[model samples]
Target: MMFRKIALTLLTATLGTSGAYAKKAPKFEQAHQLTSEQAALVQKSIGQEKILIKAIQQRTPLVETYIQDTRPDVKLYQIPVGDQYTLSRVDFGKGFFDKTYETKDSANKKGWFKGSLASITGITKALGLDKHFTYNPTGFMQMMFLDPTGFDQQHYVFSYVRREFLGSVRTWVFDVHPKVAGMGRFYGRIWIEDQDGNVVRFNGTYTGPKSEDDSRYYFHFDSWRMNVQPGIWLPVAIYVEESTRDGEKQVGLKAQTHFWGYSLKLPTRDSESVSMKVDDAEDKSEDSTDVSPLQASREWVLQAENNVIDRLEQAGLVAPLTPNGFETTVLDQIVTNLVVPNNIALSLPVHCRIMLTDTVEVTTVGNTILISKGLIDTMPRNEATIASVISMELAHIALGHHIDTRYAFNDRLMFPDESSFRRINMNHNDHDNQEAAAKAQQYLDASMYKDQLSTAGLYWSQLASRGGVLKALNTPKLGDSLLKTDGTPWMATIAHSAPKLNWDDLAQIPALPLGSWLKTDPWDDHVHQLNAKLYAPLNPRDKMPLEVTPVYFRLQRYDEAQSQAANAAAAKPNPGAAAPANPPAAGDPPAQPTGQPTGGTQPPAGTDQPVPSQAEGPQPQQTGGTPNPQQ
Candidate 1:
């Protein structure tokens, strides 16, 4: 919140400094020094805040939001950090609206406050992680802490804590507490830039105030603001970590809220680049680089893949790969174990990638398997359960099912990121889905670990049964299907002995969370599997599938690769990949995928076939497929 506003002259001086001037500038006090002068300066800031607040309110900038709720499993001595329970996670924003590409019940809806808020109480039925309280919602949590009026001197006591440099910005850290302690006031530390005297960052929680309307008010959280424009800092991210324990069973809530697209004219980053240039000169010459037919086919697949990935990264949807060898190795083992037993032939090298999201899904481009981290995080800790997930993508590769390759053309990349999803869809229809599912079952059956399918089958059954409450986790934002019937239960043909039916059972969950098995690169949102041993649940309650829990990351600024990918996905999806089309799950009948399957025991070796121009899904299609296991 904008509490204090510094003089424009001082701000200009601070921003205008060069190398020598910056070093020569006066250093701020490094220790607690709450003198009259400092208080007056803070008061002066408080007086000028109205102007900044008005500026922010008046501009209807496009704001994107992603909110997630998690549940964590704990050990005998360790705190809850075992299996994850992602209660709910929704991604949407205000400004530009494009339900065309959004999932059937995506968190991404229109308006600043129209969509459903992610609250602890709302998810209690799916997998109860809260024993004592609930939250207002994602949006409310963000706005309440950012209440400008709450920052006034009348509400909070501003005493100097210390002066520190967050990178090059010299800041005065103030310990802000309620002058009269009951409610409404924010309790935490605020980092104010010396030059602008503006509150650059606020880290703390709101006083419960304890009202009947909202039984439990707020949880401890950290909110960060970024200076997108000079002298103009706005809230960009928030992290929440809270816990409530009942004896040995402790329920934790880990979540993140992100805001961006703060502009009146919301154009995809790609659109801005497109508007600047128009080349009339057309050189129809083909590439001079020599390549074999099979290589060309593979390149075509990668071309479409690059185009999709480039756009997704720009939109903050696709997170890059973090440095972790274990995840990659696990994927290798799954593929090798499956292919070696099936005697599958392959010319193109198979690769695996990850989507930085909490939605359960598994997809493939060529032989590159793509899965969301959330899928692996919530699954049973075994190779068979994971193999069931990987087999679907493997089936897609073996069956020649994939997204459109037209994006390989340089001309196709001209479109904005908003149109990327619409133009380059990879979701399969109902027919192909069934085929993939059956084939995946066959692949698993032919594997060395066929006996392990029971766990995978149970995993599928649990996922299918919880169809109603786990809507957000089951739905995807873009591609990959997980179920046949949208609202109906989803059951794999490989089902055996599922846990006894209990509508309100908090124990024996089937899945985990995004961070349960993977560590995200806080800088770029990339992900990598953790280097830890996998252990089966000793207790049924230990299986806190898709529960929401607190998430903490070692955050750093975006790097070059992250920046470029974000730029591509930055465009909206008005003209992007196809929205939710077929069921997002595998094991359905052949829903018909792109690049028709070859007739024979195995797929044709690098056939130069015409891939689908576009994957057209049904209206109000489903997002998210089943969780995939890599290793």
Candidate 2:
């Protein structure tokens, strides 16, 4: 689906003479033999992978990929120098078939691609050339599955490493490599759940022919799936990273691809229709006063707002209205905090909703203010920075900057989801932005956040400084970007009084990495605050502002109701049945007590230790990571 125009010479320039830095592929001659019990589980997992593939094909899901091209930095290990982003609903049902041509003979150069490399290369060639080769953003999607065709022992060797726990699930970890080198196979480690034999997570890159430049075709990726249903595990996210050295200079890229909206369907009028009980249904128009001309105009504008919001929700771009959701509980409170203090009265109540994109943008849809998830994710986890962003859109609402009334007509939204950005126009022009920025300053001056404006300015300063490199992250799809096209931030005046940018100041955290504040439910698309612990940064590099990092979930099972129901069903005694005295056979996975992580709350076996970040990586922190204060 990506129409990237890559130059033919880019492969050599970016990767540097392919064979110059290529690492030798691993040999599997000394593979460990699995016991009967371990072999049975391995067999079960292979079958489960096939089932997972079939389940994915039956549903269309939203796929979002964000890439950060990084370069060496003295303070922060690596900072984003450039970026790319793509969001679309991919139909796995149609299937993506890409191949790798790894043979030495030019005529017979062909092998199935392990990742989406072939598709990316094909698209780049078809679209002609550009100065920098832009990869098909969806190329990383192929990392979700091991091998769609030959994933069995006939093609791969699985050596049991140890038993481990990823979140609450118990899994058997194994080292996997392809039996033959030229077939384009997955070379990685996989974690299979002990209970159902599902491959919950896999990490590594694809392998091609020995002589071919594998580095050009593949990058390391860690793909993880969530148990959405009782026995169904769907691919939720994949993190890709590659770091290589060319003498003293280091070059690499980091990307995160997320999938959601699996249950999305075509919009229908009937879906919006509400049926009420006859006794409870009543019209209050009879007791209300007739509408004044002013009221009538407001009503028309409100209609346009509702129509646009409803259409966006149906398209899965906007999260559904949940009563206790982030918008109602967190965002709405922030609006009230600003509105009441400034006495900004309007015809309708100003509310907020989250746009499910990671792009940093904000715009007003009539009285409703929409903020992108990326904007929220990268901000300092404090009220002032968040309030500063919200205040800008609130000013737009108060100033009567609204969406086009043409959207009031339901027929206007009949286009496909892919055409959403093209069809919907909600961005504010320069005049409106200038006026809103001035008005937003006034609102902040009168609000509780006035004193904290200095800290808020720091966040803006960081954003403005990095705006030049992080163009894709700053660009808006449906709203105005925080930064001007020329790399100057709209709120530059607000940040004019802030202190100079200092990397060594451990206490001064301008921003956090993406996904620092919110976590989206893959099934429902609802946004929630991450239940993370807070810790002070140990060094300046710990504050990875606006950079892409690896994804790690606390990893809880989905649908607790289903798990509870199954437990209840199992707890009931069979009629006239007695408990069996016989012990379980050898190699049987030991049963652990309920309500605890699998394997009795003990750490996983082997050298793999629990990561504090998402309980798997280095020390986890709510704000930007700082090194230990004691260090």
User: Any runs in candidate 2 off by more than 4 Å, and if so which?
Assistant: 1-26, 97-133, 211-213, 246-248, 266-279, 417-421, 559-631
Error of 1 at 393 (Å): 1.1
* lDDT of residue 175 for candidate 1: 79
Candidate 2 CA-lDDT value: 0.70
Q: Rate the local accuracy (lDDT) of all candidates.
A: 0.51, 0.70
lDDT of 1: 0.51
TM-score of each: 0.54, 0.79
lDDT per residue for candidate 2 within 212-251, as digits (tens), equals: 2256566778999998766788989999988776556677
Best by TM-score: 2
Tens-place lDDT digits, model 1, residues 1-631 = 1011122333323445463333333222233557986787687567545545654544432222233333442332222233222232222332212112111123323323334333222322222333322233443334423445555877666778788876556777887766555544466777776765666667776653432111144556777655555455555556765555545544555555544334432224444354445579676568455788767776677667666665555544456543222333455446545664665655544555666566676777555677776677767666677778878778878787877788666455442332443455667766777788788888878886577676667667766665455655666545564665665322266555445544245434456543578654432455545535445555555455565554333222235334643564454232112322221112112234333321111222333442222122111111112223332
All candidates: CA RMSD (Å): 16.1, 15.1
Winning model by lDDT:
2
